[model samples]
Target: MNATATFDPFSPDAGTHQGGALDGHALVQGDYGTAVLGYDLASQVLRDKRFQNSALRLMEEFGITAGPVHDFRARSIIMLEGDPHLRLRVPLARFMSPVTVRNTRDVLRRIVESINADLDDSAPVDFYRGVAQRIPSLVYCHLAGAPASDAPQVQSLSERTLSLLTRDRSLTPVIVEAYDELFAYLAGLIARKRAEGLGDDMLSYLISLGDEGKLTEQEVLTEATSMLEASSVNTAHQVGLVVWTLLRDREAWQRIVADPELIPAAVVESLRLFPRTGVVSKIAVEDVELEGTVIPKGSDVHVAVWSANRDPGRFERPEEFDLDRERNQPLTFSTGSHNCLGQGLAKAEMEEVVRHLAEHYPDARVVEDATRIGQAGGRWLVDRLTVHMKP
Candidate 1:
């Protein structure tokens, strides 16, 4: 085995290694455990079923050793593999597939316009809270057949439930309470859908499957809970990050504003640059050999997706935002069977937001002094993104 390089993937400075020699070293050792740094290696690890999502272990580490929260994480689609994973993943996948997302474009556009209509474009606005954070939950409500009035609570629940990624032990109570609320909310929503007659929505679709014996009652609830928890928080910050990245790049912004068709590539480039989920933590289920290194069973392996996205070995001029880059596939949404099921929908959401801005606020610019973006626990986040929409 080659001498393993050492670095802290969670450190604030970790992003500085992007496009550096770290990309040459496929594997690196850290206090957290092994980190797959190279683009190829990261791809391999993400696709290898020998490694499983560490979310359940993470919850246990956060002191959620048992309960509905722990039990849910243990059986969630992310933790399951093989046939079991497919059983839960396929239904959700059908809803978020490219075809479905394309059909939903009009709805997405309307939602973006509706939200932008409320923005005070005359001054620098808190774009993160005002626009980005608001869109996903609204989109969720539309998909789940819930009232738009439930958006705020849905947003709050998603954020708090996924706070486990922050690795903050202090949030144990908060995380627990959030999951409890999430379960109750999902139960009520599922019951309401049944009582009022099923409609043409994702939640209703899941219920229909349950009626046909395709999924158990518990499985139906689990699927709904999984979709709800994973839906909002990440996509919200990513929309902010993509907008913040694009608006700041004068050259790119000018091109996007001139040719609206480039909005998708522009959004993708931004996703490559500032992926919200920067690190995907997995646990080795069995001894695995990679590049001659043996990752023993039960070992933690973190894929530094931010590093892989900017790997000089994989992307030409990897640090630059090149709208013309061919095969601009990044590890932001992950890969393989366990990859993000909502990615197509997430990308569509981002593209619509960008299209709205380009069409209505071509002169928009990010207010850097009032905006705050940073990374922690290997994840990039938008704390505050202030934008002068009409400036």
Candidate 2:
């Protein structure tokens, strides 16, 4: 738990200092044939600024854009920047606001209660799939106006999308097949909601957006499909990682279980340790310079969120999962113009599930290696996280 870890730029593993904590800046040493040779704090910040919704230009570099928009492209508000950013963000902000999350807690609490009901003291079970992994999917089911029957299918497709990021290109058709099926299924729900009108729920609220704003039938379909995909994939991945990290550190679990209020703090702490997205990319709109490296015009660069969260320069005992660490809200959710809009709902969901598990099953221990699905920039996985409850 050293506070003064020094990053060695010349080492074989420059990403980690002498210690294993990630120093993101040290990893980009011009080896990738880019304009810049190393990290440039000021320059990287400028690169995140979009001159003309140009972040999509980076995705085009990866070639996922050739697929139909039905593929759940990250090109939603996530990839938008500049003028398009303002235009797109305003409408979406209505649903994602803090107030909406506050109003949704009663439903979230019921979900936590229902998921925890599966816990049995007889023998160990995969706490993740039997419980942790399914909660977020249900959250989206309620949000998308889809039935609970859709949970397993939704979970599978979300994981498939995550894995497609890391697998051989040949496997893409398999991945797309899942994406297309999920989209088709959601499309049916969209049509039903339109005919049936808004139910007393979150998903219905989104459908009601069709009346007041510029939301087209296709845009509604597009937004709902993408939101459900993102809601399940990211939220579950994070919560699973949080549980895995806590089980890896028994002391932390013990402390939080003793005081359920600390569950929120533990979620923040776990996110700092195990980021869902390993790195975030931004394209440079113009040439920039920092740290004696000149990043020429039209270059793309990545800020390793996973790496930065662990940098010793920015945190004390950077390798330890210290819930009490008084650092800023870690970059697990990104920051600036592109921070997670669902942050409020995600936090509430995490807080509820973690609180229930800690308070009710204080001695539950992870019984298998958690499986993770990931991509080039990052990945997410959770499998075989069996847990045993104390008698």
Candidate 3:
């Protein structure tokens, strides 16, 4: 199977799946013989109860299974499902309550300004370094109530953990060490939050839950570790890519600057084109049929959300980066059992960041080629982006 592995994208070559013509990649439209492509609308059915999610299947695809082995060290709601997943989500949802999110806007605004204060105006400073990465980190750190000193450490851990994602899991010890440091740091924070009680901070929110017994001390540490990566790393790579895409496409750049309203659409379109979040692995339980293909019981199923978003049948000119094109919503936040819980907060972050860029730095343009970081899930960026604007 390793010999037959190939990457699929919903672009011009996408005629294979949705354009009514199978080309390149030997993609069999409806053939179900061990093919990785979505022959049966995998996403639609995975959440359906007819199928089961088994742990053995997960072990094949992802080393980490969702079950709690020895307490909840890395166990997060993202890994859980059904009743267990729902139980955790219910309490966690309170942290992201709309009232709470609304209150964070001013903080977000200030964060963007503080990070972007000194642009590399000489030529093009690396946007990733200057603002894209910093804003999200600062915003999340503030929300979590992490101390000033821990912000940089949290950022480093996010970067290192993401780096391990793309690897073949060969560097286990290094990855283990990276996580050890991160979890240890979070564990300490949890202790602090427990003593301090609920306050006007993200730590306080978690502490409130602990007091209510909604979250255990162990769960608190696990969630803190999960929260930082989910909040910062993806946003950093995403914003960097979106900015790069717009800068290259003159017309798209103009559209954003002129209307500013289209930024949200652009954000969605960008996610489909250059997904920076994840290429998740889902475990399958019972045997499933799709387009004449039967995935045997206990199999590791990989659904390419990014690839699905690019399907020509669902999207016209699927690969051309057309924000105005009529298409179904991309799975950036996903749907059903494991949708992103922080989606509401993430959207607000993207909207605020983009709005600020257009309104504040209308003249910003790319000065050099953007270099993207290649990690497990494809979310890393380093580039020199020169923006021309008033300081």
Candidate 4:
């Protein structure tokens, strides 16, 4: 179940069944050195002050020393540590906090309803293309004060940029090429927004950082584009995953549709069962011992998020998907200071779609089985999710 052996996190027995390789270890040696698979230990690695993301080190590993892509990674709040991370994250978090998300709920609901209304249920409709991919990208564009017309461009570039992190080496050139176009597009948008004065939007918030002397022009550009890229890609794919999972079970789908109140719990359970990001990458800064395993300093640590979410120790019948589970807590978003600041927004986006599908297309079902794009550690991603909305 180590990284070297190539395990699919989406497989039925990944962490649920007894005697599985991944389930047998607190820490297992893998291609990335030591991997923490146990729920408790994985949580420790994520929250521990001794562990940090090696973005610069990763750039070296990927042989991306200097470029727009490299520059973005270096300045990214998600990649920074200590004060630097906090400095950028605090203001950005305020803009995307629960209150902000609640304010935007009406806008998000309208977007979802508008998109779902156009879906033709007569034939197999590609949910990935028609709905999942567009919603978050458009919403992000609107929130950033960018034109809604820019969504298609954002979708293309963000998806390609994310390919940089995939295990597929062939996508490196695609990623590099994407950075060129993405950087130029975002830079132009930043310039225009700057010339026009600020607005009540996320991009305006970043521009204000420059005005306040808290962030430089380049820092503002990098952070704004990075947030756009991450939020769209992460939230879009997650919506697809949740839809695919729910459609696979008629009874579960009916239960949620029958009671709209269950949409939130259903979304939560989907996240637990099929976390969008399968692994949280980290590097140990110093020697650390946890659960009887000692991880030396400078070792690459891959926290198995998918496995940890399904750990039998914390969850009863961890293999099963139950929306009504009385007590459920999953580390799908990781923990501690680095926990997803966009969770509130992500949840609202997800819940909106789920609620729409339940209320509008209660009889919808998967027209064809979803297919995985590749054999990467994350297999929950549905390359093509076609659903047929038949009454």
Over the stretch 1-391, how does candidate 3's per-residue lDDT look in tens digits? 1213333332233223442113332223222122233412645654655443332332323454444422343356665657866767776677788887788888888877777677655555667777777767777788888775666777777776655545445654455566677777777777776677556787777667767887786666666676775667777777777777776677887789899889878877876666664344444557866545566675545555555566565677776878686644776666666667777777667777778878877777776534443323322244444444433
Estimate candidate 4's RMSD in Å: 2.9
lDDT of 4 by residue, 1-391 (tens): 2233344343445544331135355677745567666688788789898988765566656777887688788778867878988888888888888888989899999999888788777777888888998998888888899998998888888888887656566677787888888888888888898798779899898888889998888878877877866768878888988888898888999999888899889999998888888778788889987656677899878777887777787777878889888677788888888888788888889999988888878998886654443225543566878888673
TM-score for all predictions? Answer: 0.98, 0.82, 0.81, 0.92
Global lDDT scores for all candidate models:
0.91, 0.63, 0.61, 0.78
User: In model 4, which range of ten residues has the least summed lDDT?
Assistant: 1-10
Model 3 misplaced stretches (Cα beyond 4 Å): 1-42, 49-74, 326-328, 368-391
Q: Model 2 lDDT vs. the true structure?
A: 0.63
Ranking under TM-score, best-scoring first? Answer: 1, 4, 2, 3
In the range 1-391, model 1's lDDT, one tens digit per residue, is 7527578889988877864336357788867888887888889999999999999999999989988999999999999999999999999988777888888899999999898788778889999999999999999999999999999999999999999999999999999999999999999998988899999899999999999999999999999999999989999999999999999999999999999899888988899989999999999999999888898899999998998898888899999989888999998999999889999899999999998888889999998899999999999999999999877
Candidate ranking (lDDT, best to worst): 1, 4, 2, 3
Q: In model 2, what are the clashing residue pairs, if there are any?
A: 371-383, 372-381, 373-380, 373-381, 374-379
**Top model by TM-score, which number?**
1
TM value for model 2:
0.82
Count of clashes in candidate 4: 0
Clash number by candidate, in order: 0, 5, 5, 0
Q: Which 10-residue window of candidate 2 scores lowest in summed lDDT?
A: 33-42
